[model samples]
Target: MHVVVVTKNTPDTAATVTVKGDGTIDWGDSLVVNPWDEYAITEAVLLKEAHSGKATVLTVGTDEHQEALKHGLAIGCDQAIRVWDGALDGCDSLGYAEAVAAAIRKLGDVDLVIFGRELADIATDQHVYQVARKLGWTMLGYVAKIQALDVAARSITVNRLTEYGTQTVRSTLPAVISVVKDINEPKYPTFIGIRKAAKAEIPVWSAADLGLDAAALQPRTQQLRYQELPKREGTVEIIEGATAQEKAAKLIDRLIEEKVL
Candidate 1:
């Protein structure tokens, strides 16, 4: 049972983010593991321990991404891997999927891969599904619970939370699943775990190491610029009436005048 959890560093929820005058984003001073990913990390660590298997947590980025890897390590992931390359600097989600799929292939025999339903910073789950597509593996999303996982039989059963309702799904191993935040309570790092994680050696996988072409890693989508949202301009007016019925009538008339009736 080899569980691979993919995670990344994101700005802390409480941090203030501002788009700079130069079209760059200033993410502030604090970076933490994606809040939603903490649940996936916890689930991966638990799965590894229950099956007595290896749990490897990985990310795609530079040193900043080590923040997430160490967080997973401190939470009990057996090993940490960082996938990166200079050629991947401005890549989009498609490029990210390629790199992640390559890394998973290099680690061969990975029974299951887990990811958070969405990234806090980027607010998208495209990379998760894209990686599964690139790997030609089952892709499950919004998993509220992993009901069962049998490494020997190469099978998994989970409860999916969707807009309609929860559905029970069974899939073969070597699949990729994105767990929702409610799946489990993410445990904080113990003092000893932190100490050990800080001392752990994490290897970085470059594009060449993953047998990827530099040109293929180029961005598919180009961002023209990031401009701040237009300032909201409006005025509030309180409807005044001597009676409730009168106020209701006035409100209706106002709605009709505004074409909102």
Candidate 2:
């Protein structure tokens, strides 16, 4: 049971968003691990413990993202791999998926690949399917529960959540799975784990290292600018009436006056 979890570093959700002069979100000093990826890492750790196998964490980002990878390693991954290059900036979902797939191929002999259902910042739920398509591997998305792993049968049974309800699915091993937030609770890294992770040397890979062509993985989407959201306004109004009906009438009148009706 060799499990690989893909993770990404994203802007902190709590940080105040800023717009740069060029009109792009200013990530001056904001970064955090994508929340959904945390679940994938935790699940990988659990699977490794249960099945007695190695769990490796991988990420595609700049050197700044090493902190995020370290966090994953601290949570229990046996090792971490990071693919960093300036060209990775502004990579669209398709390009990212291609890069990840290429990296996975380089590793070889991997039985399972897991990913967060979607990245928090981009909110793109395309990577899982894209990677699966590129690798010609089985893909199970929005998995809420992993029921069983039948090594002998070379398949895994899982429950996927949908708008209507949940459906049970059985997919062959060496598959890719995208887990929703409701799948499981993520674990925090312990002090000992953090220390070990801090000292761990994360291997870095580039496009060439993964046998990827820069032109093939070029980004399609271009960010024109970043802008801050408009500030909210607060207004209050009061109306006095002699009866309930009069009060209702007054409210309606106010609504009409404010063009809210």
Residue-by-residue lDDT tens digits, candidate 1, 1-261: 899999999999888667888998878869989999999999999999999999999999989889899999998999999998888899999999999999999999799999998999878899999999999999989999999988888899999999999999999988999998779989899999999999999999999999998776778788786678898888877899999999999899999999987
Candidate 1 similarity to native, TM-score? 0.91
lDDT (tens digit, per residue) of candidate 2 on 1-261: 789999988888888776767776667567888988989999999998998988989998887788778988999999899987666667887788888998889889788999998888877788779999999999999998999987668899999998889999998998999998887899999999999999999999988788777786788777665556676777666778899999999999889998989
Off by over 4 Å in 2: 86-90, 228-261
- What is model 1's C-alpha RMSD? 2.3
Error of 1 at 24 (Å): 2.1
lDDT of each: 0.92, 0.87
Please tell me which predicted candidate would have the highest TM-score against the true structure. Answer: 1
In candidate 1, the residue pairs with backbone N, CA or C atoms under 3 Å apart (3 or more residues apart, or in different chains) clash, namely: none
